[model samples]
Target: MALWGGRFSETPADAVFALSRSVHFDWRLAPYDLRSSLAHLAVLQSSGLLEDSVAEPIRGALNELISEVAAGRFVANETDEDVHSALERGLTEKLGAIGGSLRAGRSRNDQVATDLRLYAIDHMIEVAQQILALQSALIAKASEYGDAPAPGFTHLQHAQPVLFGHEIAKHVQGFSRDLDRIHDWLDRALVSPLGSGALAGSSLPLSPEVTAKNLGFTSSAANSIDGVSDRDFVAEALFTLSMVGIHLSRIGEEWCIWATTEFGWAKVADAYSTGSSIMPQKKNPDMAELARGKAGRLVGNLTGVLTMLKGLPFAYNRDLQEDKEPLFDSIDTVLLVLPAVTGMVATTDFDREKMALAAPLGFSLATEIADYLVQAKVPFAHAHEAAGKCVAMCEASGRQLHQLTDEEFASIHPSLKGDVRDVLTVHGALESRTTVGGTSPSSFKQQIKESTAITAAYSKEFTDKAKAFSEMMGA
Candidate 1:
């Protein structure tokens, strides 16, 4: 029975246990519970709520519990209600009332909230590493494929030639933004809620700052009711993870398309691809597909949390316990999936031959051809029309615009000269794009250098954050 049941006349129906039990999901927070106890016990002894003689045994036993839980020896029953009661039962069994005295200045309300927040703060840094690993894979692939031409598409139609590296590099920017969000969310989730007892501040003269210091929070909550009740920080982290997952999904979708037989320009590595059971010859990009599908799960988890909190009133609810399960699920899904994706990306093979062949098929150099006429003093609108007509001429007959003889070119546009063919050759078209941020080889190499520098800077940032988190955890 719960500690509070002594005041109730009747025990809750057995069915209430089924509805209210969160131990199965929240068991993952057992380590955080032990850490909380350590902090609260420290403050309790310092404030003389308990003598050091009492606090000493509680601290030692709590450390042992942490090891038990870490080693997979801890389990709680429905009667234990949750981790808090389970830990209390363990302490009471070991040290008599001294264990019970540690709960003096705290309530399960603020305690569980603090545990959830601490758990989130630790996990967010991990998820950020997975994001960084994905980013590293992308940067490596981008740098590897520097200036390897691929068809750039808009609205699913071939629009122009682009270095394959630049296409992959664009998503590096998106993931970097996701990294930003992960840190911002972690910053919010790190606020401490330990001293908000029940629906009010503790009657004991507890110092929240001391507890926050012990648990690695920069500060403690300002309002007692809000501290225990508000889970917006958790929701914020989930929402950010959802966005990162979505971005991965979008990248996965592109890889799926690229790996298909219809578009053989990109090949999945053997480790990342799986063979169909019935079709021995098939090499499907299963990891990519799963990453895409898991995005929906993360998005759904975010929605589940948001829906749970939408209309609820302030302060804690049984519904708030619903938060941890979805978060754990989403984090587990992504962290497990991202490393595989990083491997897939790191090992992907770029089909330079197929990309080069496909590069010229859609009259991809039409804009450059237009610029050719524009440089010859033709008005751009007129130049655009003339380029369209040239495209139509190639489509009507079976000859490319570049294949037209000087006599053939003069028929389409009198301003066109024989040397226009020199300007339209594949090498010429790729070379003449000398504008900043253009597709020219020189421009892409410059872009690759700049992107490489950014990747190095981001690597240093993530590495430092990881070090700081390690130091804070005393790991």
Candidate 2:
């Protein structure tokens, strides 16, 4: 019989019970369940509703359960519908009815909410750590190659020359912003929901504050009706995961394009690539492809969770159970995807020679040409027109502007100097862009240092969060 079978005269049919079962999908949440229950029980004792005689044995049983599971000695029976029942079954088998006394004033409504928060907070630490690793990989790679010249793009067409490392660091900066969002989302996951029994506040005089403190929550909800029914935290988690996937997907897509023989901009390490059976020389970026595809899946899962919570009424509803699977799935996907992409990045090779050769083409220095005229006291619009004519003359003659003779350059614009060719040189073009965030070697070095420090600070913050969780879990 199910733990809640006392009100029913007969058991549910196989299909019915099977349909209602979540143990198959949610068994991974066992650690989270035990963590939340320990805090809840601690609060129960603090509130004077439970004596030490009962709470102590329950605490011992819970710890034993955690230890057994950690050592791979625990298993769930077919009859268990969820982690809650699996845990109660395990405790009863070992501690008898005394183990059952822990459920006196709570309902699965609040119990599941507690589990969700625990799961998010726990996984947030993991995801943040993974993000930091990827950032470090990118930073190391940047330090190695940030000064190598590459072309900047506009509408996917080369528009200007930039340092390759600076381009990669731009993406890392986006990730830094995203990691901040994940931390902000952590706030939602750190609110205790244990004492909000079912939909209403428990009448057991439960100490929500004690539970929150034990669980590492900043505080508990004041309105019980809002507490258990709220899956806003799940939505925020999904939203955060969606943003994470978006960043990963964008970078993955670029990696796939770059690794192609056509682009020849980067080469994936053999350890992170796959070969085709039919094509003898086809080494494909399967990891990048999967990362891109998983981004879409995470987005879809986020939408699914949001849709499920869209119309649910207050307190607790059957719909709340729908929240668990998506949260677990999204967290699992990001956890798997983040580490794989990070590994790929750490091992990939950049084709600096290919990038520099391509960087000087596609009129990448045209802006420099216009700016040169502007610096020579030419009117801005007149400067733009003169540069356009210079490019047109070069194209007609099947030559680059830098290859033009001084006499030919003079025909396009009298302001053109004999030194214009040198001005159009790749090194000159890069060094000329002295703006703070531009792709100059000197400026790019500054960005690398600043971004590396940002990642370091984030690493420290993540370590602190994990340490707090560890202390709270007493692990």
Candidate 3:
């Protein structure tokens, strides 16, 4: 018999039962569901809604169910509508009349809300840890390439020469912001929705605060109606995961470009690359390609959940059932792809010589030449014109900027004497921008140090938070 069938003469049709069951996707929430139940039981006994003797046997049954779950000996059957129903049946079977009392002050509405919150928190920590691993890989690459020159681009055309380390640092900073976003969203997600039984506050005088604290939340949801219906936490998590996908896609695009024969800036390790069928000499960056492709799926997951939550009423509805799959898919997608992308980044070999050779091509030193004229008291507008003239001359003669004659240089501007050659090399162009956060060797070194420090601080915070969560989970 169904848990709520007492008021009805018939059970749901087979098709309806198939559509209503969430055990296939939501079975992962079993542990969290039981955790919430255990916490709720404590509140019930304290409020005298459940007597001590009855609560003890119920607790024992719940613990036994937990052991069965942990041992993989217990699972939801086709007759069980959801995890809550399945566990309730298990409890009743184990403790007869007393087991049914566990549901006196709670509903599956609050139970599911609380279970998803707990699941999201634990997975967010896992996501953060994997993100830190990627960040570490990026930082390691930046340190390895410290001050090595590469072409920096705008609109897919080389615009300046920068340290290779600086290029990697940009992505590192993006991911650092992604991590900050996770931490910020986690604060909102930690609010417990447990005591908001069904659509209203429970009449059993149970303490939401007790359940919240025991379950690792810092606070309880203030409004019962909002508590049961609020899925902003899932939305925020999907948004955070979408941004992570975007950031990874950006890196993946670079990896795809850099690994190309045309760019020759980097090479993916054989372990990370794939062989093209019927093309013996071809090596493809399938890993990077998949990372790029999966970003669209992550974005779709976000949009899917937002659409699901858009027209729902203020309190819990059957529409809320649509929330879990998208949230679960987002978590699964990120967890699956992050480590692969990290491995590609960590194991790839950059050709510093090729990067250096290409860095000074395409008149990338033109900006330095303009800055040189600016230093010589020429107004920047005139200096920019002079630099353009030099570039025009080099293009007409089919020569590079550094290959131009002294008379050729003087024709552009009087200040552009033979000494103009001083700023024409890759190192000269890079080192000239010595301002803070510039690509100069000193500034690049400082950035590496700061990146290392910031990464260390974030990692420590994650470790501490994970420890606290572990303690709360009694793991």
Q: How far is candidate 2 from the true structure (C-alpha RMSD, Å)?
A: 1.9
Error of 1 at 295 (Å): 1.1
Model with the higher TM-score, candidate 2 or 3: 3
- TM-score: which candidate is best? 3
Model 1 quality (TM-score) = 0.93
Ranking by TM-score: 3, 2, 1
**Can you list the residue pairs that collide in candidate 3?**
none
Q: Model 1 off-target regions past 4 Å?
A: 376-379, 405-416, 425-438
Candidate 3: regions farther than 4 A off: none
Supply candidate 1's per-residue lDDT for 166.
73
Clashing pairs in 1: none
lDDT (Cα atoms) of all candidates against the true structure: 0.82, 0.85, 0.89
**How well is each residue in 261-356 modelled by candidate 2, as lDDT tens digits?**
889988899999999999998899999999999988989999998998898876788877888888888888999999899999889999999999
TM-scores of the candidates are: 0.93, 0.95, 0.97
Report clash pairs, candidate 2: none
Poorest 10 consecutive residues by lDDT, candidate 3: 466-475
Candidates 1 and 2: which is better by lDDT?
2
Using lDDT as the measure, name the better of candidate 1 and candidate 3. 3
User: Which structure is stronger by TM-score: 1 or 3?
Assistant: 3
